[model samples]
Target: MKKLIHTLLAGSLLTTCLATTSAVNAMTVSPQNWWAGMQNSSLQIMLHETEIAKQQWYLESYPGVELKSITKTDNANYAFINLEISPNAKPGKLLFKNRAGDQFEYPLLTRDKQSAERQGFDSGDTIYLINPDRFANGDSSNDTVQGMAEAASPSERGGRHGGDIQGIINALPYLDELGVTQLWLTPPLENNMASYSYHGYAITDFYNIDPRMGSNELYHELSAKAKQHGIGLVMDLVLNHFGSEHEWMKDKPTTDWINFNGDFADGKHATSHARQTIQDPHASEFDKRQFSDGWFVSTMPDLNQRQPLLATYLIQNAIWWIEYADLSGIRVDTYSYSDKAFLADWTKAIMVEYPNFNIVGEEWTSNPAIASYWQAGKINNDGYTSSLPSVMDFSLQESLIQALNEDESWNTGWVKVYESLANDFLYPNPDNLLVFADNHDMSRVYTELKQDLAKTKMAMTMLLTTRGIAQMYYGTEVLLDNTGSNDHGDIRIDFPGGFAGQKTNAFTGQGLNSDQVDMQQTITTLLNFRKNSPAIAKGKLTHFSPKQGVYSYARISEQQTVLVFLNKNTTAKTWSLDYMREVLGNHKSATALFNKQKVKLTKPLTLPAMSALVLVIE
Candidate 1:
């Protein structure tokens, strides 16, 4: 075999190989590197080049390692090499060569100590979600690149504002001080689209970070730096689709790689967005296909996860990221849109590899039944099983908004929230659900509450103390609002101090108004208090029905008990503790979290109107 000359090309290593005596072409391999001793010994490495399949390949003899097979696709440019590394395999370079004397090196690196035993964020953590482009710009030089499709336009709502991984790393101290235990940024992978790519849903390169955002090394650096601040990183991943501008669009990998044979057919192939069809007993095949196989938009080509090769590719891609980036968790975007079986396999593979790791799927449904069906322990009537550890609580998000915005009524207001939580019986593990007031996709909670600071505090206080893993949007602490417009650009507005020319800087508390400071203080207090609360972490929740515009609940644990009262009334009211006798057992007195005053639990508690009161009992 002849040695191949290697050259660095566009952040990825490309090898110039001889496929034939007269032909020399470049090939790129994915998953930059892999680690030994992974739970699964099997590895499927993909090679992309001109007529890559034409060459016969073999792996150099290595102890405890064997090349199982090489699968070629319908397209001449792609080849999938399957290899198995034994449990005792050590870190070393594996040299692979073809019959035409072309060779390349693949590295099997060492795993971090106790990597598989890494703990995922749970009820004990407060996840802060950030839109990197809107967060801060630590590096302004990479704002525009020679090959990137879009330029940085700070004024344009949809244009890239140049928020990179360094920006997130720079704000780690602020996040840690605010008691944020985990950070979930929108997909940091390369979008590389012509427009509106700042949101990061349209993924172009799964293996690489966007150069305009940062490099792969920088992303790894982010995980390391964030860990030092006691923060875990949760990567947002898009598996159902890819940006249309991806190289796969230019050169077909296989006939079945993309759904609908890579044709949108003028919006006729668009998804119905009816997520219910997945669990509907009588749902038709056509409806299921229309919802699952249809494209999200013309710019994003839906992937054909039903294809076995593609299924393996996505599953391995997710695992590669977890091992490569030292990720704490994964938040899958458009989770249900992918093939159900593939999702099961994808999630199961990761869970099997890292039993302690967590993955939350975005179901985006207001129905508890639909959302709970995707959770791990659900005994689905359809005989379907899911390995997903967590599901987003869209039902609570919608109900909480309504509960705060609507007037007091028997079936509305606080009752909406009460009924929503009552549906917790549907989930196998209610505490594992991801609960949040607002996220990157919707209107800010402050704006939803009509910029009412009191209501905003109540909403956040209730959310933080609720019985689930909590996630907060980037600027909720300082009241970032998109009052008049519901546009995505407006919803994901720039962080004040994160960029230049901003009068206010949230990081330093510069030029902040009274309400902003108040909200900030309130969030900091709740988050900090929640950090050490045993009741909030693993306690049993007991709540009372809404009465007289007040909703009350208690988190009971062996070490601590917490009482929360949310009053929606416009005036203070005396709340009876008679109904909470079972939960308040022998707790005569407790200290209020907000006011730091001792209150007798036996007496009728005075609940301030439109406020949340949290009491801790030792």
Candidate 2:
């Protein structure tokens, strides 16, 4: 009877607790667990409960971790506890006690061996960009999770089509066979919004992966399998705003947790343009405030980094993910919209922890001058210094595509590529930049070239052999295009083999047309050759001015040199080997890279019309 009464009271008290406080806030903490043996000894853990700060909760003594202080915010529901962990802290759980004598356990895990010294993605790696939700469906049972709002609607283009982490794991062999060394997946964090959660930009949970996709353990499994295939994982992170349904939004850590709160009568303020004023020297304070303080959308609340605690929380969240997932690289979305000072500190902290790591920021602008300003070593007159080592080369993507589609002329044709490279002096480390022909946000390169195969090949050749890191979208191998519409849903369509019952399976080459097969072959050959070609990987690039209907360039290293020529005319032309004598030298013999034929370079080489020829000068 005594045990029965205790159990009945416990159940009754739990029911009352749920009625009073929402399920998420009753008893939990952000970053549910942390790893031991981190180089950084200081760790801040945030706790959430119903007026927990006012209630009595004392920390129990634990080994290897010292309770520094319990910091409370203006809101009584939240508390920030700072802990100083010793370098030798063992992987164990720390206990805390409530007034009712209830104990809460927070687990501390051990870091992987030599985790701090892991190498990141570099120029030598060709990145395969995948939208996980649209990639493949490996498991049918996980199509619609129980608690999730959105159901899998395969008929709708934008609906969730049952692609999960298992789908990506299933396609690893195909990716590896294609010579892809890195996988860059868009944000996989939970977005519990009722509608349009397929894109995953709006995050509702930081600590857990979406159940519809998979569990946290499954993500770790995917990472481990990817490493076995000699592939690195790059995570796309968005730090600007989060979904309104985030746990903290119900009762913010403080009144100022979100920006633009209580600023308008209708609470429907406009999203900030956040445009050129960020780079302007004479911009007004209003512009800066509006840019940094405004929300992304009504449903996505912008976080205020001006609050010191919020700033630290965001930084710690990033570090946690890196350690948790063993990530190789991070691609920050809306990189320039966040607080400039916070971004500098965030990058510095992560780099200090892992010196070999690489982070590329997404600044979708076509101006090289603007893009280079955020690079690490650029000397800006404004006296601003950035720790970001790499940025996406949107200018090169625009120039290369525009150059390929236009006619050869004095100011047109291949001059774009030459001039684009001429501006390389603007960036501190241009080699670390990510160069691509087209990504999810833009039209496919094939579409941009008006479905011309020769033009497509020329652009692909430049992208693969260019100076910076190269990235290929998921369906680019099979000529994924949105000729009639530019909607993101259309652009990020389901991969041919990703879904079941599809007529064409790009992976197995089933139901594929000749053009798709040939394109895939072309990319596979180029990528495999590049994997072993040191000259193309880290070589010094030298190119002559686009002249006489030929745009030619050479990648030279100590061991070998590769000469690439693109003909811009409708008729076949003979390219003169005489002008390239300095780089080519008196090398009388050469081998064609495409066909692997030993050709004598003693005289002018015959070139096909509107074709690309790569020759290894011997």
Candidate 3:
């Protein structure tokens, strides 16, 4: 075996020299290993070492595998090895040698049985979004590690709180009991930033998990154990930009690797956050470039995906994580900030590899037209084709908050939500969209609704029974709120009982107040029932317009029917059922999901003020 040494040099690609004759000691390769028999026969391995481009290497007699070519960039330190692995190839080690007799072996592993056929989270599953660093502190030892810039500061809201992967693994039973079917943790990849690294969005290393969180093996363990509890794992992916502290920033693979030639120009190249430019036919080229190529912040340098090599690296990095972590789905961050052409190709490659899988992108726009433009089957006016199966429904989320906060009127209150849902015609597959009231980036649902438990419950009820897949931010059931502050750290506050010195322990139910307990029970009941309800999961959604301070909708299927009434009234009122005859369809009496009392559909239903009423017909 030859020794290939890797270093943090600009475009340095490792090439081994014979151990017997050369003194080279080690090397680094992106996607260090691969699986045989993948749908995509081609693979590109990025080798980074000193003067690696000058080495002439050849494959050592591998069956069903061929070294198609070795391409080098302007930087001699970087080399890209492209290989074609046929379907007949089996899992084993493939050897390579240069003319100087230096040799190295790459392992091609076997895929897991039924790996490609894995089912992604959909309307049937309730996804729980967790900020891993704030969720729990199962492992305090790793909170402060050697060589890491930041140390744990549990008292400071924005500081690291020592939560690790083991904490999530420990909370599996708790999550299972809450009836959550899927977990979408914020990215646990190595941020390696000096500050505000707890949110895990600024990725410094794509291939490895952060040691502060856990190892790559431990993350795989979380996936496996989560499966045991009947939950799927959805990884959070970032492709638009990376932490400025990343090694790539110091030693770029190519001159054009970073957007604007690795210069932020004192925020001159910052994004306008004008996502609408992507779908706007009249959008100027300058506006489009500013939105796409601009850096998010000085600390997050935008990636130049137009560079073909960097594009391939990102696409392969996503696939590698999916295979390595046994992921069931992915939630892309800042989806529209990257180059549009690259976004199409990247999504296409992932879907082609796993046709049954799903990927949801975060467009973060309240405009349904712009959001729907990215779904897989939409026929855009500009002839843009997208392979994205799911997108976050920011329109509904924004309207729901407004509806609950405002007074009832023709153009206000519940009408806002009704009009929002009326725009569903804009989406190709509305049911495949991700519906959530709040996530990590914004304020918590409870806080946004002014810590009103009734309003919060109404929001959760609406989401869980809606047409699209539902997602809940962690601590929502217990009414965690970030009142008077919109800080990311405050929004992602520590989960009670997850850490020490807290009066409340949501896990053990030890110090919870009545409101917390009631909220928790409400979510549990709705989630468990939703888990089995064909009506809520795959039914047709038919909602009536706002009438007399009430917004009502019905999810009807052959097996069951669910009726939801959200009343924002200050006083209990009798809601007439005459207008919903089309959906009610001969149903007489129904059972209330919360209290299990039989409701007579034949008479006017009495709706509790400022609360969500859910009834089921069987």
C-alpha root-mean-square deviation, each candidate:
1.7, 3.9, 2.8
Model 1, position 146: C-alpha lDDT score? 84
Error of 3 at 150 (Å): 1.5
TM-score, structure 3 vs. true: 0.96
- lDDT of all the models against the reference? 0.91, 0.82, 0.90
Better of 1 and 3 by TM-score: 1
Tell me the tens digit of each residue's lDDT in model 2 across 377-417.
98987887899888999999999888988887888879988
Score candidate 2 by lDDT.
Answer: 0.82
Query: Residue 120's C-alpha lDDT in candidate 1?
Result: 91
Candidate number achieving the greatest TM-score relative to the actual structure: 1
By TM-score, highest first, what's the ranking? 1, 3, 2
Model 2 lDDT-worst window of ten: 1-10
TM-score of each: 0.98, 0.93, 0.96
Error of 1 at 52 (Å): 0.7
lDDT of 3: 0.90
